[model samples]
Target chain A: MGTFHDDKGELHGITVVVETTGPRTYIGRCFEETEQGIVLLDVDFHDPAEHDKTKDEYLQHAVKFGQWKKLAKFVVPNDEVAKVQRLAELAP
Target chain B: MPYDPEMVRPMREELSSAGVQELTTIEEVDASFAQSGTQLLVINSVCGCAAGGARPGVLLALKHSVQPDRATTVFAGQDLDAVNAARAKMADFPPSSPCLALFKDGEVVHFVPRHMIEGRDAQSIAFDLVEAFDKHCVAAS
Candidate 1:
């Protein structure tokens, strides 16, 4: 069976935060969606254990000021992702 | 994929030799940023184009009398986890390697992104950082 994902979804070409089941959280530009995973460019990968601030606090900051890009590219596997939300959605 | 560590060793050492702590793991990055006071984090990259200016410039900037409490670096491609963690701390700016950020009490006070370093000479880049140091850093006793 092929992986089913929207090619024309609002997530493409926009800044998003992809939270994984594990400790990792990624914020970046959604480049594309492939069967393997969601391709992100200019990514900022965050491991909650490595940070002093809570994930929600960090997201709140991003919603206000925006996030810096770290990795040139990253691919998050579909099964590994717990939730995917637009960075703007988290804004008030 | 990350670059070959062996290949980037010299590039990494250029900054490390200047008394800048090299953070190669997430834990190390977190620990470095967790401290109180001003900190300087350099997102080192293997791009000779920009890094040529960034590396030497950072070294030169440290010579200024006013300096941050600590200086640290993480290689962009060769140290993915470490670089990512470092960038997370600098979430307010657009991500760019060969970048410099000054944090005062864990808040970003100044940032120099790739575009600012790309065509600039080492002396010019150093001037930019030195100016930021003058504005944001304190002279150590």
Candidate 2:
């Protein structure tokens, strides 16, 4: 199996949906990756605990409509992140 | 291994200068949590967001009239034992450096993880920390 390091630069500049182990989820353009976390630019982060939309509903809407940018840049820690995928791959 | 003590001296001093006690050993961590009343525990890190936001924000928050009974900090890379002990106290929280937690009578009442720090200015961070302080901390005479 490849290490997390192997995928570091490959995702740069791609619009990806990132789900974390915590309450938040992010959809943004991957700017950089470090041992610490993935740096995302123009991110739309949603915490269902504080928002009206469920994670599934948000993902569905984002897949069809595209992400709504909220944060200009942020880091989603590697340990807290559950999954990261290309936004285009989610299209049906 | 711990970070070069000299290199991280300034980072430690930033919080220490603001009256946050440094917790460098497991014993210190245990003793601090054992105390009654509210305390603020900062898991310090060398990350840029920490330097730019968390530390400055915490300093500003402490200026509020209402404040925790005590404030303490543990360097993430330099104080391994204390950091681990602190994390054990906050088992519910996912481990993250540049994090902050408020404890009342030994229970965590509020927490600010690294994600909340990233991409924010010190003023924004201080605003949130002050909100937590107002809600959870009591004013000292």
Candidate 3:
């Protein structure tokens, strides 16, 4: 766990994924982290609802540029997180 | 012990209406856990956040080109045994309702917890699921 925070600290300016208790997923720049959870600077959120598949997956594109109609800052509780992974470490 | 079924009917319907099968008993969970295939077990909730994002996001992700072989759901605060059984399969993950459990060959591969759903948008949630499906679902390969 000690090494984990150090690794996360290095990602302060980089992108990361926060997986929370609802099993929800959020992607954004690593703003800051605490004992509770990480605060994502410009997060793009995920949920399980139905929408048009034919439409372009604009959100994925939004993630890279940090564009989305969402709350600018997301504070994730450590207790609610299942895990956190750097975007670069995840499969494309 | 179980929740008043009538009180949780709408929340159950939200996902059931979205084609998510409800898991009420531990036996059903045990059976599902034994099956081989990519399985998505969503721990459903009554929170406004879930209604706004998690549920909608998940349903959208399932619409992708590839998805889990079976998608099931357990209602938090309602189906006690089923939720517990599902969490038991999750290894050490702390219990969080409105979680997304992605399983591969009966092993918990990816899990999404409630804190993740709190303030995220539907599209963001959808993107995560699509990526998970691509990387974890055998059918996607």
Candidate 4:
């Protein structure tokens, strides 16, 4: 998990969670807000073949809408990564 | 389909002519943000907001005496990886194309999301940004 700080060096109350979805790559999500920054909870979903494409697709959507602010990512542990990976596999 | 390089070329030139750097890679993004002063990152797009409002707002804002130390842009659809790379560096904010990010020493200070620019006119947005610049960029000292 990582935090995003503002200009005053104060936390933006945002947390980013990073979960592994591949060998070296991770998927991150925000879960809580803090005075210093946001807290992240990692999700596990580590299927390279599946997650890679999905990641690219999500990024493409963000790019298309000029929604670049939504693309923050972070790195995290393997177990947490696997959880999101499994979840992604089950996702419709 | 890919964007028309020829069409965007002119727009790119206009910004460059105004002294804005074009960040086409993650490294460039890092370098620009890592610098020790206020920076303006423009999420450039071909949408109506970009063409009708954001671009003009940027031009007007640049004319302000109290502006950022540096100004840069990334073409959304055209510069896919570069845009994504830059977004990753931003960390928390949700993605909003045709967006405007004000960074001071690699940290995001002010963000103007797409919704903020969507229906607004150039002058109005420029006024907002210039105000931000005056407060954050100039008054920082």
Q: On a 0 to 100 scale, what is the lDDT of residue A25 in model 1?
A: 91
CAPRI quality level assigned to candidate 2 from its DockQ score: incorrect
Q: Candidate 1 lDDT, tens digit per residue, A1-92? A: 11123563546555678999998899886778778889898887777788888888887766555566678899999999888877756657
Which stretches in model 3 have alpha-carbon errors above 4 Å?
Answer: A1-92
Q: What value does DockQ give for candidate 1?
A: 0.09
Best by TM-score: 2
lDDT of 2 by residue, A1-92 (tens): 00133355877655688989988989886878888899998788788778798887887666544565677899999999999988656656
TM-score of each: 0.62, 0.66, 0.59, 0.59
> In model 1, where do residues sit more than 4 Å from their true spots?
A1-92
Question: Residue-wise lDDT of candidate 2 within B1-141, one digit each (tens)?
Answer: 888888889988999997999999999999988899999999998866688788999999989999999999999989998999999998866566688898999998887766566556889888988898999887777
Give one digit per residue, the lDDT tens place, for model 1 in B39-95.
999988876534568888888899999999999999888889998999899775767
Candidate 3 chain B has its poorest 10 consecutive residues by lDDT at B111-120
lDDT tens digits, residues A1-92, model 4? 11122342221221222333444333333343345433333322234565545655543433223223223433343343443221122223
Give Cα-based local distance difference scores for all models: 0.80, 0.82, 0.71, 0.63
Identify the superior model by TM-score, candidate 1 or candidate 2: 2
Q: In model 3, what lDDT does residue B13 have? A: 84
Number of residue pairs clashing in candidate 4, backbone atoms closer than 3 angstroms, sequence gap of 3 or more or interchain: 34
Cα lDDT tens digits, model 3, A29-89, are 6767878678887566766454342112534433222334256788888888877776544
In model 4, which runs have C-alpha deviations exceeding 4 angstroms? A1-92, B139-141
DockQ comparisons of all candidates to the true complex: 0.09, 0.07, 0.03, 0.07
